[model samples]
Target: MTLLALKNISLRFGGPPLLDGVNFAIERGERVCLLGRNGEGKSTLMRIVTGQQQADDGDVMRSQGLRIAEMPQDVPKGLSGTVREVIASGGGKVGAALAEYHHLLHENPDDLDRLGSLQQILDTQNGWALDARIDALVAKLDLPADTDFNALSGGLKRRALLGRALALEPELLLLDEPTNHLDLDSIAWIENFLADWDGALLFITHDRSFLRRLATRIAELDRGQLTSWPGDYDNYLRRREERLHAEAQEVALFDKKLAQEEAWIRKGIEARRTRDMGRVKRLYEMREQYAQRRNLQGTAQFTVQDAERSGKLVAEAKNLSYAAGGKTIARNFSTTVLRGDKIGIIGPNGVGKTTLLRLLLGQLHADSGEVRTGSNLEIAWFDQLRSTLDERKTVWENIAGGKEYVELGGARKHVMSYLQEFLFTPDRARSPTHVLSGGERSRLLLAQLFSQPANLLVLDEPTNDLDVETLDLLEELIVDFAGTVLVVSHDRAFLNNVVMRTLAFEGDGRIGEYIGGYDDWLRQRPVATARPAAGTKPKPAAVPVVATAPASKSPLDSKQKRELAELPGKIEKLEAEQEALGLKLATLYASDPGKAVETQKALSAIEQTLATAYARWESLESLRDA
Candidate 1:
């Protein structure tokens, strides 16, 4: 069943029409993902669906009594109360009774007279079912029901708002950037929850993994037009490319014919003949068509400015331990980052990912041990909090610093032209930083960071509000960059595609080093029992009990046996390479110092590879004995 439709919709805000003769519809079980660039009219169209805004022209059709709820991009400003009370407010008058009853029963249990009155209201209104549903939702979202909504973190606050949206029991739900600040575990949980949701969903998100897992269809808003593709995200990519290619061809042919007509009409006396009037009229129509055509926006192009090469040992930590606010952040953690190494740091919220980066950069003092940074290491830090940006300053002033020109690739370019390369118009460049959207601010940061030269890039949550196209381009730039990168991100696909290794925080200040990305860590990490909750007593150690091995135990397979036999030889070769590199490093430092960094990088690689081989060999031997 079609829940809602937009027919011949047209909306404009001063300039061009954001939505021109748009037509769209959503069915009962559809999961539609909206893809668009920043500042497009996606949010406006959503408001139109909810009746919060009216289109300047056209009709919005909805089914009789259709229910719609939106989980807004920014949390509502005036929400105040416990989590339960906030969610209950979604149910209207009956929910008000439940909220009051809930408050009285918990906070004023001794006041039975008031509680009795509230209970009677609930009974008469059939509000008990709504109360029960609120209970289930609170537990499912793992929200602190009795806690003040204003006290929760950003991610938790978003979850509470989502609970309220779900409480509405709407036939259609709209979500905007649902995974913005969530950790990996929370994102996974929400993905699972929404996959099982029965209602139709229309959401805007830049998370490719989430879109791939949820979207049954893809919809794009481009240059005042809405287009829908009937398949997954990958399918849309393939088909959109074909569509654009064909469009280019058609436009080229039309322009050629128009040019030929212009030449014929330019023949003054010959074209003034009566028979030529029809051809002249057709030329005028072609000009109108050409004037109305809307072109596609160009992709953002940027490159990092390179500085002088740094020493081979970018940074090293030994027995490093740090603590803040009486909580352990890192305990006896150690790692070596050589030049050209790209490392990704990931953990739950407030789990010290940024702290680790600071510790490595010598920006903060460690509680114990030490960090050693190499020589000539120029660092450019992309702060997640956007503290580097001055909200009071205009975009051009923030980036240009009173200069009319900036240097790019050894050439001086005007500030306006530089900003334009990032898709920022002159008017937008003059706008204050506070007025820019999340995506625009990110772009501004990139423009600022790339204008200067550096050898070490430290990015903290840099992927938060960027569009998918920019994210892909950023990933490519990082992969091709000559400098070392230490990025802290929650984007799984970005991590998988960009980083060489990962540093994951396992609980209790323990940081584990894995050879690859998020999925690689999952495969190699050992299965362990859940830890006890805070303030819980430790369980007594269990007495060991011996058991006999099963008689039907299978021997190692042929492939496993072959891998086991080859491990020793690989380990030996790596050790020999490690020794040679070490000796060469010493000789180069004394004789040809410029070549020492390359030798040192090779030595570090061999050491890590050798460690992996040793671990594999031990595992194989244990399996053989079993």
Candidate 2:
């Protein structure tokens, strides 16, 4: 059954429409992942579906009596009372009765008369079954029913909100960035839960692992259009790439033909003499089409400014022990980090992953034993809280630090140009940091982190709120970084792709050392009796493995070396040609409009060739450096 459908949806605030004549539909038992960059109006589309907002011009079709519920990207405010009260709110009036009855029974057990009154209300309203169901849900989610909802951690708060959404018994559930702040364990549990869900689901997320696990179909919102791909994320990626390539080819061909016709019409005297008015009218229509085209957003270019290489040994912890809040974070934990090693730290949220990082970095005092810091370590830390960013400051000010130029790779680059590399426009760069979205904030922090030179990078939850493309770029940068990295993250795919070794934080302050990433540690670590339920404490046993040092890099072959040496000049020549073509195109547009299209085609070809050359150069450079 089709739960909902949108047709010819168009919405705009200013400038171009965000959703231009968009069409989408969801049927029963379908789990769809909504993919897009930040500020793409995904949440607005959800609002349209739920009748919270209306499209400027379109139709939102829904099956009669369809119940839709949404778990918003950020928690809604002004919610008070116990977890049960908050969840029961989803049930409407009957839920209110149940919440009051439960609170009365728990807070005043001896008040028989009041409890009896509420019980009678529940009985009359046929809410006893719902009461029982609520209890079951609380247990199933491992939530503390009596605890204040406002007191829960971010992850637990999200879980409670999810339970509330579930309580509505919605036919269609919408979740926005459901795994935004969750630990890996919670993420896995939710993935499994959603896999068995009966109703249709539409969600937005940046976690590739979660997307792959739960999304049966992918819906991408790009350049003011929504496209649905029938299959998994991997399939969508392959098909989308092919589709873009084909679209580019079609566009190139159209431009070429348009240019030829334009050149024909530029011969004003000959054309007037021939009296071919149809061709001139066709040229006007083509001009309209070309003018209305929306170009794809530019991809973010990242470059990490590297510091001088540190000592071969980065840090060594021997019999390291630390405790906070009467809980042992690390008990006799020890590890050695060498140059060029990428180490990942994995554990539950609030399990002292950051504490361990501080201990290793000599920022926190150990209760016993010691940590020996290596000589000349230039450290750059990516803080999860984004505390490093000043909310009052503009984006450019935060990055430039009041300077007009930033030293990147030991070269002085203009601050605005550098910011542009990270995809921040002049207006956006001038806006206060506080006004940026989560994804934009992540990008700004990255810009700040990479602006300075560092040989040792310590990242805490760096993957949170970052789009997948930016995440992929960050992964490539880390893998290519010729330095030691100690990162704390719960992104499974990120850990798998970037880390060469893993450190697992098991119960009883036992941190285990294993080779490879999250999956690798899971294979080698001691098996547990069972995975813990949501909101339940986990007791993971440590299993240590000795890590091997990375092998020495091999010399590049003669052919590869020659290609690497020639790439820079080749790239420069292509860029020069591209610039000249662009200049010609502009001049033709003003002086001879007919010739501009041909110049544009040439410019596009040069740009494509330059991109390919640059990619090849980077690949060979990484190989040579390795």
Candidate 3:
């Protein structure tokens, strides 16, 4: 049941090798995820595998007469028709068989053999039921069947393309970034659909949650080489770390032994003709081995500037209501935000997450509510559209604003040097913004934001197009940030690492606050109905419940339960430390300016430590009576 084999694959485009002697294979029912840094030729390898492009060296072997269908990253051009027609076209064999059967009837009504073969194909493929199946699929995917393919939104277009690819039911499915433009519901549906798929799947995507759930194996493409590990995402992470650590130790050991051998030879051991000649030759051989060894590269560096102290009452809304195009997005919503609060906004696409943010920022007037903000609040916004960047401006010009040098960390550095900090080359710095890749643009925007520290960070889909390394860096910065953050991102791993709580926008303008990340929100949602598909829940398996100490592990003691109820609010207020200190600092500023400065200093020092202290206290008290 082997689907395909790619052996000794080498692809070069007249420059550095894109893929170097790569070995890859897919068997039936294997869900493999191809991972790599941006611009590492992952897409190129896909094209080569599908025969859309050719590798300079190597062979792509497939079992004879195997069917392969691909959903490329970009929608191909010249596709003009309704969504239904396009999906039918993607039903390659069904459509082809139907055409052949009709043609045989027209060419020779007496040709029973050919007609029989065509009818058998048409019947086997369920050609007569094709339209109904496509309709159901399109409806499930929320794609408008009657709408022209080109007129659909980018996300919808991707769904349509995928629908077509799926209709074909090929032996192998190749997908690139399938979850990029999808909403949570759509992503969940795809995950469920792919789980039941019987064919082999190889895809590239930045969705860690998707990979964790569906990927049976992971292949990492780095430095023009492919390294595959058989496991899910979390398992791959642990194994890869161990593999790298082992490699480091091996290289260190070899270097140390080679150094000792070289030292012995340098001490005139080779001059002792018969006695030392063998040892001397061994030393030379060891040097050759050690010299050829390569070590793992360092990870990307990411830093966030310390934000200045802000008042505790960052921003709050009272009865916030908003409506656009005769549809309500937020209705009578009210919430308070405090300094150092990390809140994540999540909902289906176009569910007013951005509108709510704009209302809090006072960019939009709510229909019947008021927004209040502290004077000391400084906001840094990462727009989903990246409108802050000018397409006509070069990277250096966009960041530097015509200045050759910018002040960073109290030192004046050349703008080019600063641009290089984001891994942009000198030539790239001079290239217009339109030419940069999505990841590159995101990097530039982040660099600009990090350069100017702010007390409140509002990021919309900040993880979009960011590589795994940068995603890790961003998560670290958010966790360690001194300021408050309100972000909208679909990246589950990123949300889990960065946000302590989430604000989920349920349909029809109802906003609910859930404790914890995306997975936590899912847990709090209503059963299997949380996702798009209904009646698809698996039957629960029966299991015996064993009681520890004969069910003597009693309910949390009254005191512990009481503390648990109060902890969430208490932690929120504590995180907003500067706001809590506002009045005291103001009074001290009048009475003793120097004392006020010292008090302000103490507040910042204690804020983060206090949060951790409260968390530890909660954990201890929860287990105290149990």
Candidate 4:
């Protein structure tokens, strides 16, 4: 069944339309992701769906009595209640059911009819099993049961809020930038939870891995238009590239045809000048026809100078450390950057990825160790804050230093051509840098960086505000770059595509070097470090196994062997019944109003039976294995 639908939705914010004639729908149990660069109306669309904001002109259709829960981008300030209390405040039938369950458990009711009425509500709401669900959700988000919600860290608070949202068990869940403040462990936990969740999910996030694992479809907002592609992020990107390439070819063919026609008109005009006025008139009409058929020019080209050769050692650091706000961010850190190296710096927020970048660039001095650069190295750095550019200057002046150049056509072109490649038009190129958006500033910086020659590139969060197209261009530039690069980014896709190695910032001022991309680093990270506080000591490295014993005969005794052989069949039969019951419940709820109440009762009974069968099968299987 369709949960929500938007028809011909359009929204404007005092300027151009942010969303124009957008039509989208969310079906029950579908996980759709809203994707776009910042200020592209993703958040606006979420608000419209939740009824917090109304579209300028459109209709929103929602199922009757449908419940939706949203996690806002910013947490409310000065929240007076405890974390647990806040989580329990999700409104709707679940909240009412929980209240009734509490009343039935504690209040001694002299009226038997009222007590029985409360009991029925409790069963209908699944209130008896709510505690187990809450526990599971809290554990999945890695939140401690007794931790004070008011006193928790920012990351922990975010998790606690997400846990509360899940506890509501709403039919639709809306999460915006869910992983923005989470650590890697928390991110992994959320990924696993979303994988198993059986409700409709609509979220906006920058974590590529999370999107790839959870999203069933991708919807991208660009230039006031929404384009949806069915499948994961990888599939969307693949198809987008194919479409772009095809469009480029078509544009090229149009340009070729226009050029051929123009040439023929030029020859005809030259021949008719000496022959007849009628021929000249005809040639003029042909010239006008060819002029109107000219294709729009493509974006300007990006060219970079070959990087100069560097010494064997590109960078070196010895026992480098830094402390801020009574926290040791980097301590006793040492690494060597050799020639032709591409390294990525990754870690949780405030773990010192940016601090390390500053240390390498000599912007900050370490208290103990040394940072040494290779001989004759030229560096071009892209700062996360974009502090390198002068905000008071025009984009053209910033790139060209107030210079003008004459092209082959003898028309004077300002440095706007370079800016246009980064999506800036002629008028926008004349605007002050202070007014540029974050994404525009990022692109302008890259255009300026590539314009100049540098051997060592240091980029901090280069993918922060870039769109998919700009990111692709940057990736291509890095791959073709012959120089060394050290990038710090939280974008997994960008890191995997651009970097060859990783420098991870471990807590307590230590850094670990992982020998691959983000995925490779995840696989090796489990054994890379040990947390004694988590009640597990580091294990010794494993040796290669040369041989293993194999047995064709059953190892168990006769009685156990018979039980083990029968357990598999019993478990399979129970699983099939459980699946059938679940499907029946779904269909009944969708198609038959009369069967809805009956199906709920039947579902509860089937669930109980399935639980018993599963327990018995598990016991037999365990005994056989033992």
Candidate 5:
């Protein structure tokens, strides 16, 4: 059954329509992930569907008694009172009933019927358990229950808001960038939570792993349109390409027909003595139809201008110790950075990932520590705070900064050209920094970072507001760049793609270095047995006990044993080629889109061959025993 239906949804503000006659529906138990580049009207459409905002022209229908709990990208302001009090009072069924009961008693000293009805609802919904639920969430999220909501930092505030939303336990959950400020552990915790959510879920997140694990369907809100594919993120990519290819074919067919009609009207109409007016009008209609599909564009293109090379040793830290306000950030931490090193930094919130980055850059003073830097090191910083952006200045002004031109790759390029490289048209270039979306702002930052001759790049949560496509591009560039990169990100898939190693913050001011990326780090770390509570199940133990191996197979015959020995070698070669193809796919994706397709097919074929070899080898070993 349809839980929500949005029909002919259209909205506009001064400029072109942000959403143009959009139509879609959410059925019960459907988990849909809404994706779009920053500022592509995703939030606007969400508001329309949730009844927080009315569409300029559309119809929205919600099933009777439908309940929704939402977590906005930015935490709401004016939230006062203790964290526990605010979160426990999100006004879900139990909370609402309890509050209403008290209100009626306050207004009239005695209202028995209303009081009884409200109390029944409160009891049925387990309203009294609100405190327990709120406490559990606060503890799990590492938030202080007694603190004032306003006193917490921005990240803490977002964490509290998420806890509140989760505590509400509504039938439908609407989350905007839910994992934006979460740490690796919290992100994983929430991923598991969403995995078991028994509701209609619609969330907007840039975390690719999260999307892959949670989304049963993927929806793209692009340039005033809503399109959906019936699968996870990977499947969505292939489907999107196929749909675009089909649309291209349709456009080609229309063009072919249009050409014939135009030719007939121009030269075959009796030397234009009497115009076939109907035929002429038909040609005009076809022209409009052709332009319509072609006009539909993506959010924006992303391109990273190449950077200059750096020396072998980018920077080094020995016994780095830093603390502020009686809290230790990093203690006796040390690491060496070599050129072309793409290292990822990950840790829990406030565990000093950002602090470590700053210390390496000499932005922070590390007490009693000596740091060595390469002579050719030129650093480019992508700050999560975005403090470098001038909100009052236009986009072009921010990039140009009181100059008519900028220096890119040691060449004096026009400011317009530099801005256009980031997909900024002339009109948008003039728009102020405050007007751009988060993704656009991120792109703008990249444009600025690439323009300068930087050998060392420091990124702090750089993927926070970027789309999946842009993330892919950034990953490729990081992997292929000739500089040293230190990126602090919670995006696991991105970290795996870009970084070869990771410097992890393992609580209590300690930093642990892992051999590979996020997944590798996860595999090496000890699993935490999360304390279970109401509505939460205890996690399975880290290592499950396995039964003894089946009775040893009888000794294989000489021929069977020989084939078995050769099978291992054959499988190894196939696997090696598959790994090579994976790397080739990355390079091919950046250089030639056409070859990427062929490379993927080849990779699939290799997997099948390897599977067949393994199956045959196993069967032969069993046959020899028989």
Candidate 6:
């Protein structure tokens, strides 16, 4: 069933429309991920959907009895209650009204009929079971039961808010950048939770892996229009690449056609000259047509210069440790940086990844060990704060400040040309730094970083505000960079694509160096009861067995006897129930539209059961028999 629908939606912020004639419908149990570059009205659209903002021209139709719970990027103030109280308050006004009604009922039972009616209403709404649901949500969000909401850290507070949002159990959930402040483990937990969630979810996030695992469809908001793709994030990316390639090919064909027409027009004009005015007019018209056709092709170019190399050992940290508020953020961390090494530093929140970067750059002093720098090591540090750029200065000045020669390739080149490479147009390059969006600022910083030659690059959360296109450009630059790099980023996709090595800082002040990309590190890391098989003895159960007296009856034959005996029963029972549930779900979708909201829940339960049965069946079927 359609849970929410927006028709001809138009929103404006005193100027141009942020969203123009946008039409979209979200169905029950559908997990749709919204993608767009920063400052492209993604957050504004979310606000409109949640009723916090009204569209200038459009209609928002929500299904009757549908409840929407939104988790905004910024946490609102006035929530001064304890964590438990805040979580329990997700029932909203209903919970408050029920509590007051219950108190009155307990005090005066003389009006038994009225009190009983109120009790029935509360019971029907499951008001009494809300606490249990809240507890479960809190546990799932990894929040401590006794922690106070007011005293929680930013990350913890965000998790608490998420818990409250989930506890509401609304028919539709709107989340904006839910994975931004979360660690890897928390992100994984959220992915799993959303995978199992029954209600419809519409979220905006840059985490590619999260989108790939959770999203069933992708809604991309670009140039004030929303387009839907019928696949996960990865599939959407693949399809987008093909679309771009097709667009490029079409533009090329148009250019070739225009050139041919122009050549014909030029010949016609030259041959006719002063003899025929009609021929001249026809040639001019043809030129105009070619000009119009040429305008159809978009003009934007991104190019990075080849980086100049420096000597080896760009920077080195030996037993680096930092203390803040009488607690060690990192301890005994050591890593060497080669001339061409692209190292990524990642860890949970508050794990001192940034601190380690600061230590390497000598911005922060280590409590224990020393930092060594190579000869002629010129470092270009892109701090997460981005405090280097003066907000009051225009983009032009920010880019060209203190530089002797701002021209590149003698095209009257200024900061504008450099900014253009990062997708900032000439007009935008003249805008004040304070007026730029987060993504624009990030690109500007990158442009500035690349303007001058540097042997070493230290970037902290460089991908934080960058769009996918800009990130792609940055990745290409990093791959081609001849300088050493030490990057601190939570972006798994970026790290995997750009970095060759990883320096993982675990929360307990221990850092581990892993060769290869993020995926390789994950594969080598300990997961559940499974550890990396590095010089370890195999368990007795895992060891292979050989029978000495198996001349008449082979060992393989004996094992096969046990497997065939168990295979049929396992397959029969699982297949029977799987078919039943599949039919039941199909019927539900066909009959009651409201049942669509519960489909994901039912499907998850079915999947769990089927997976278990399938695993057992595979194990039984794999054994050899006599």
Which pairs clash in the backbone of model 4?
none
Where does candidate 6 have its weakest 10-residue lDDT segment? 294-303
As for lDDT, the candidate ahead, 1 or 5, is: 1
Writing each residue's lDDT as its tens digit, candidate 1 over 1-626 gives 67888888999998889998877777776788989988788888889888999999999999999989888988888998899999998777888888988888878899999888889988988789888889988987888999999999877888888889888788999998888887777777778888888998999998898899999767788888887765568867887898899999999999999999888877777545745677778999999999988878778898999999999999999999999998899999999999999999988777888899989988899989989989899898899888999999999999989799998778999999999988899999999999998899999999999998899999998887788889999999999999999998888888988999999888889998989887787677655623333223569988997887866646789998999999988998898887676556544532343365455557767778998899989988888888
The residue-by-residue lDDT of candidate 5 on 1-626, one tens digit each, is 66787878999897668888887777777788999766678888889877889998878888898888888988776667667656765756576565455557667648898898877776777876774676677787778877778887767777788777877777888989888877777777777777777888999999999999898667788778887655458867876787779978987888899999878777854667787788789889988876665244443444345455677877789998888878888888899988888899987777778888878867777887787777666788898888888999999888888698997656788888777767788899999899888788888888877777677889999998888777877887788777788999989999988898899876677788888988788778654422332346777658966888787666777987789879989999998997787656544533443465566568768878988998998898787767
TM-score, per-candidate, Cα-based: 0.82, 0.82, 0.75, 0.64, 0.80, 0.72
Error of 2 at 374 (Å): 0.9
Off by over 4 Å in 2: 106-120, 267-275, 529-626
State, as a TM-score between 0 and 1, how close model 2 is to the true structure. 0.82
TM-score of 6: 0.72
Clashes of each: 0, 0, 1, 0, 0, 8
lDDT tens digits by residue: candidate 4, 54-118: 99998998999888998776676755344544555553465555544444455655667766776
lDDT per model vs. reference: 0.86, 0.85, 0.79, 0.73, 0.78, 0.72
Cα-based lDDT at residue 482, candidate 4: 81
Residues 1-626 of candidate 3 have per-residue lDDT tens digits of 55678878998886567888887767777788999888788888999888989998999888898889988777888877677777777877676565455546656879898888877876776887765677777877888877778987666788888888887668899999888766677777888888888998999988888888898668888878787665457756876788778977887888898888766666654555445677878987887776654334345465666667899888899888899988888888899888889999988776778888888878898888888887677788898889999999999988889999977666788988887778787888999999988778899999788767687889999987877887888898888888899999878888988998898888777888888998788889765336545215766767977766654455676886787777777777666774556446534533453465466556656666666768766675657656
After superposition, the stretches of candidate 6 with alpha carbons farther than 4 Å from their true spots are 12-18, 77-91, 94-128, 144-154, 246-308, 319-322, 402-412, 526-626
Model 2 residue 407 lDDT? 88
Lowest lDDT 10-residue stretch of candidate 3: 585-594
- Candidate 2, 481-530: lDDT as tens digits: 99999999888999999999999888889999999998888778876613
